[model samples]
Target: MATENNVLLTDTADGVVTLTLNRPDQFNALSEALLAALQDSLAAIAQDDSVRCVVLAANGRAFCAGHDLKQMRANPDQRYYEQLFAQCGRVMQSIVNLPVPVIAKVHGMATAAGCQLVASCDLAIAADTAKFAVSGINVGLFCSTPAVALTRNVSAKKAFEMLMTGQFISADDAAAQGLINHAVPLDQLDAQVDALVQTICAKSPVAVRTGKGMFQRQRVMSLGDAYDYAGQVMAQNMMAEDVAEGIDAFTQKRHPVWKGR
Candidate 1:
């Protein structure tokens, strides 16, 4: 039987795993099932040695509208919301802490927790027609969950303004604010994402994984500590087989063939 916790669609190719939010009718809102599915997908991806990158995308006109308000209204239980947010947080944290890089492919509206999802990813690409907002304040509910990722990705003042105003911003605006890496026409979104994934996949997977981990770990540390940590990581990576192969390829003036070692 199709399970409640299996709402997410996953596809893997060339070391990239794309996870799609599948609740189209609700604009891909985060329901208990969707949230659980996201967590499960991330957990599985983390253990899969073949997967080196993840792309979080959606199938609806809206990337996500945040939590499933109808479900919350029907249940009318604060405990339910609590549990849902907790699970959502775990999923977001998994993206941030994953050794593989994650990219958010934003196609339409991304609001509230949806906007936070983009912020949590290591890189984000959006269609020029897409928009983003922290709209919780509009409904008299502050977006506490989304704030965790949003605040970290952009400056505190910028993040606070978006949340407090509850206003929508264009994809270009999002890119300018550092919320996304690039914004292209809607028709070009897939091609752009594919190009990006291919570029990342062409690199040494082992170095990519190690470097991504180091970037996450050192970002939260003091400058000296970060340098010390990076030095250790670089020293270790220098001895890896991929590094040796890369050096040999450079000496021979040829494209390096990565074994993903």
Candidate 2:
């Protein structure tokens, strides 16, 4: 377990690393410091083979309120804004580039960049009472950065509506719209997330890694290229020791003893 800058906290157990945004007072806003902390943590996790899964969880009443407006306003310079956004973009990209999958555990408000964080994750689960929006439009600023991730998860029209209208949607609505995987009662949120984590952790690490990497990369490729690439990935996956064990165990009617990494 580790806490950095008192803005981010990390704990790992049973191969799952939970990175918690610790700024409860600010609704866990993406302050510059917090973004830097996340970047560092993510980089470290990318190289950590011991970690099989990541849970992007947060503390406090709101999951996140987006950028630290006060901090941004304090340095109201074009150069500052450009650098700030670029930094934020890198952090988001890092999440997508991570070898292991990340699951966002959302509660309360997840607005603007907060919502982007959820969308950037490989999977997300939210409390039914949670609310989400790309509400920068209300402040006369289009959520351009958030849009990149949002549009990838949601339909163009639906994502545009959220960006243009700045209207909050319920967690169930978010799930239905594909912004989140599931929305459960607040009390059941942890259980649901834990169940999902366990389900993923039970699989062969090599298969999970190979599949996640190929899944994202193949999305942007042409249909023919995608199939050709997927075939290569699958062929490589078949060569893993765990795959052999997995098939053998299935044939023998026994649980697989996974040793892949």
Candidate 3:
């Protein structure tokens, strides 16, 4: 386990790393320091072979309330705002670019950039009582950055409505709209997330890594291009030693011991 000024906490077990945002008093707002901690931690995790999955969790009643509005108001400089937003963008992209899957364990309200954080993850599981919103509109600042992720996770009309009205949606509504994979009772949140983590950990790490990369890369390609790219990736994956071992183990009617290539 590792901790950063008690602002962020990291724990690894059974090939899963859980990063918990620890600023409960601040509602785990993405302050510059917190963002820096997250960025550094994610970069480190990207290079860690022992980790097969990551869970982004929070330690507060509100998962996150987005950027530190009070800090932004204090600075009020265009340059500062630009840098801050850019930093936040990098953090979101890091989650997307991670070789292993990232799951957001949403247990409370995720507003503005917080909502974007959930959307940016590869998968998300939310507690039934959790809420989500791109709520900067209420403060006269358009949630432009969050909208990038919001639109990708949900329909344009639904994204637009949330952006325009700054209304909060229930966790079940988020799941229905494809923003989250599941919405379970608060007490079951940990078990649901753990199930996913365990399943991913049990797979061949190399295949999961290659598949995750292919999934992200193919998302933006034209249909024909996607197929072409996927075919090449699949061909390459087939050549991996792990695949051979997996197939042999299946044919032999026994559990496979993955080498992870």
Candidate 4:
């Protein structure tokens, strides 16, 4: 659905929600209004059990160009900057906190906070022509905010190189550095993203939701703690009716009918 201003467009089908960033003329920069819209959309989707997956896509020549530089300059104050970054951070974290999986579909340049957006998603599929960079340094900023998610997705050395040098990396390099899941030709970008979405949608929703949460939580834990947490999650998952159905169907050589318990 198109927002009042049409800055963001959303469409849902087959249990998948597609959130498309509009404002192509501005390279889909994250203006305050756009951020608010996105925040609201994510919040709504989080509560919508019907949504099994979300695709974060964009229109125009660039996926996103980071924060609105003009708007930033317009209000050059410490408090304003702090609030803006905080708002952006909330939006990014919402994606991680969402029970369902989120996939970034990148087809053009994604810079600064844009790159951060890609890093924040659980999965990212970029087109061969897509480019990524944390280029805030080029404009006298340090990309400190974007670095939060960027550091988590890639190695410290590689993340620092991009943040400090403000250089762009090809989609293939992004995938190699673990910043994205895969890089395909521009023509296949949609199909590749859809394929992943379909795969996730085919799974039991309850299992996928539990697994996604466990995956994120374990990432920040010690190895031993991770295993402990994982074991608990597995035990809980086994108690779900879907698990029994899945096992029985497997042994019986029949397709499992998931109740999403």
Any idea what lDDT model 1 has? 0.90
> Over the stretch 1-261, how does candidate 2's per-residue lDDT look in tens digits?
655569999988889999999999999999999999999999999998888999999999999999999999999899999999999999999999999899999978999999999999999999999999999999999999999999999999999999999999999899999999999999999999999999999999998999889989998999999999999999988989999999999999999999973
Which runs of model 1 end up more than 4 angstroms from their true locations? Answer: 1-6
Candidate 2: residue pairs that collide: none
By lDDT, is 1 or 4 better? Answer: 4
Q: Write the per-residue lDDT of candidate 4 for residues 1-261, one digit (tens) a residue.
A: 444449889998888989999989999999999999999999999999888999999999999999999999999899999999999999999999999999999999999999999999999999999999999999999999899999999999999999999999999999999999999999999899988998999899989999989999999999999999999999999999999999999999999998989
Residue 42's lDDT in candidate 3: 95
Worst 10-residue lDDT window, candidate 4: 1-10
- Which runs of model 2 end up more than 4 angstroms from their true locations? 2-4
> Which stretches of candidate 3 lie above 4 Å from their native place?
none
- Which has the better TM-score: candidate 1, or candidate 3? 3
lDDT of 1 at 146: 96
Deviation (Å) of 77 in candidate 2: 1.2
lDDT of 3 by residue, 107-126 (tens): 99999999999999999999
* Every candidate's CA RMSD: 2.2, 0.9, 0.9, 1.1
lDDT of each: 0.90, 0.95, 0.95, 0.95
> lDDT score, residue 225, model 2?
100
TM-score of each: 0.95, 0.98, 0.98, 0.98
TM-score of 1: 0.95
Cα-based RMSD of candidate 1? 2.2
